[model samples]
Target: MAILKQDLSFLKNNVKQVDAEMFTSKIRGIMDSHAPQTSRTVTDRTSSPWFSVESKAVKQARRGTERKWNKSGLEIDKQIYLYHKKQVRGINLTAKREYYNLKFSEVQNSKDFFNLSNELLGKDKNTKLPKSIKSELLPDTFGDFFIEKIEKLRHTLVSDFNHDEDFDDSQSDASTLSTLSPVTNDDVKTTILSAVSKHCDLNPMPIYLLKNC
Candidate 1:
């Protein structure tokens, strides 16, 4: 905040010399210096709701036992590991059944029921057309289809309503806006502040930073 205030003060003093482009560059520089960009990896995978702490603990134990058996190569250790693995599978199945039963019992409406069903069937995944089908010509194809439909509908409507009437112009009056109130600095500032705070790649700085300024 102090850095921003100092930079903004300097900018204010040199405001007359700064053109729109120069001002935008200066603001963008300040923002970049203060808050640099960072990159991260993201995944769409989600953990199962039915996988409780007990299930995780049992799974972890099974893994540990399996590791111990692998190291020792003893019959007893192998049997223990196998027992733990069986227990894990059984616990997971029971937990999943209980989770689904509770969810089903809690469903209060058809929407909720359908949502749950879709979730269970993995039908809730995002639907996207293949990239191969999304060519520049696709938009033209859609436009042509709609246009043909519109033309056919227009012809049908025209044939159905055969009677035509003369245009009415007596009620219409010609009026011109001779003057408009000048937009003040306050109005511009208000408009900028009121706008949605969504950042664009081509923008000089984030809308949040502009609002702060």
Candidate 2:
């Protein structure tokens, strides 16, 4: 943070003259210098969202103990491994319970409540249509259906058409949006502050860092 502040202080004098692209590059360079990016491969298997660092540590310890028990074939080692295994299970259950409890408390509407309920019940799996579905023919099918319906409706309307009916323009409501108010400095600040703190490859720095600076 101190480094960020110090680097950003240099921008005060040349803020007006600095080009947008150059400014972005400079900020990105500073960020990369302090926090270099690293890559990791993702797999299909994922950890539970409720799992914490403590749970991971305990699980790792359990694995170590189990390995020792397997190697030594000692009764005491087996008991210690069992103890750690139970601790991991208990921690996982407690974490899951607390996580769902908090989620249930924060639900504001029936839709959200039902969604959370489905998540808890493991019923929120992605829905996919069968491969046998003739999706390629759907556009033509939809076009034909709509065309036939519209043709029938058009014929019915023609039979019931009243050409002598007079329209009343005065019955319509009047509305006009001639101008928008200019955005103020406070509005800009508020928008930046309210923006999500997510960072992407294109972003020079995270919004949280921008806010702090």
Candidate 3:
């Protein structure tokens, strides 16, 4: 195609006769005729490459058992779910280890290693600030950003007190119950929030808002 394009008479006639769209399509057709389409769709690329067919089948089975566990009143139903869950976990772990090992074999340097690591761990591309947000108050507003992180951490770890009992029951079995001092969960949350407040609450909200604005 490059050689064909080089003929002076051909180039002059081609441009004179073909519209822009037709010219583009001809070039594209030439390229596609040589190579198969290798691009992945968004959904295909977003899913874990380590997840194999066997792993997917095991995971499907696990989810089936989880539904059974949720609806059935029998302890045996729950036991079956646990068994499937373990099988799924084991298969996924082996798949991921093999995946990383395969990647490790291909890497030749620190840059390659880091790139592969990012592929495995995922990059924080979604968390970036907008490119237009170039605020001069960013330095002084650091306090607000830090406070937001603290609030998110607190909310995620402790959650609401109303849901604690059910969450605890779901996580515990007779053999796995905590053996620590009989401190109530609510009490612990209160202690943590109080400590956060002692340090954070000393500053007035207006001061942070003013700096941020």
Candidate 4:
């Protein structure tokens, strides 16, 4: 295009038929008016080498390399990414099937509590809980831990009555007939809420407001 323009200008100037600047301006205007528009759009330039690489380089020269842009920005480890994926899916922690029922029993023993806690901790590890989960013994919140403990007790009680090698129907009937100690359950809940008060609570006013208003 530049070569053609140069050739045209030479011929026009030599013949002295038109003013060079005026003729060039008129030709440019005509070409611009008649020409189909370029296929340039914002989306087209998004992946362009000039914008993606060159412009990024210029920006990085002025600022530091972005921690969220290219390879350097998204340098998250595989474990971290997997952990975040689980979190996005709302898999907060894992637990076994019978854990809940056992925790609420009167006959749940200390051994059962340990087993339940271990299983819950294993699940947390599977969920990619941070090292903080291990170091703290109990997690940051007490509600989950306390509930697990209570459930373990219930399981122990049921197991003792149902699964003992010397299990007698008469003895089993007596043990199984026992009800949960409300005091024990309440104490466990209190301990849990004390630890996780900020994360767990209910405002009773909502129900009252709904009923009245």
Work out the TM-score per prediction.
0.44, 0.42, 0.37, 0.16
Error of 2 at 160 (Å): 45
Query: What tens digits encode model 3's per-residue C-alpha lDDT throughout 116-210?
Result: 78877887535555455467766557778899999998988776654764575665565765677778757865665555333243232223221
Candidate 2 lDDT over 56-165, as tens digits, reads 99999999999999999999999999999999999999999999999999999998999888888889557664465498976787789899999999988876675425
Q: Cα deviation in Å at residue 186, candidate 3?
A: 80
Q: Per-residue error at 146 for model 3, in Å?
A: 37
Q: Report the Cα lDDT for residue 107, model 2.
A: 91
Model 2: how far residue 105 lies from native, Å: 0.5
Candidate 3 wrongly placed segments (more than 4 Å): 1-45, 123-213
Model 1, position 189, has a per-residue lDDT of 75
Which candidate would rank higher by TM-score, 1 or 2? 1
Q: Evaluate residue 141 in candidate 3 and report its C-alpha lDDT on the 0 to 100 scale.
A: 71
Give the clash total for candidate 4. Answer: 12
lDDT of 4 at 76: 57
* Among all candidates shown, the one with the greatest TM-score: 1
Candidate whose lDDT is highest: 2
The regions of model 1 sitting more than 4 angstroms off are 14-19, 47-92, 99-176, 190-202
Per-residue lDDT tens digits for candidate 1, residues 1-213, read: 677878777677887798999888888788778888779998886669999999999999999999999999999999999999999999999999999999999999998999898988888656655576667778887789899999999998887676434546567697869999999868987897888899878887767865775
TM-score of 1: 0.44
Residue 10 miss distance in model 1 (angstroms): 4.5
1-213: candidate 4 lDDT, tens digit per residue = 454455445434564556756555555554455453377556544442213333444444433333233334455544444444444333212222233444536446887776656754564434545565565755545668788899999999988877776755764445444676556746864665455323112331122222222
- Local distance difference test values of all predictions, in order: 0.86, 0.87, 0.68, 0.48
lDDT over C-alpha atoms for residue 156 of model 1: 88
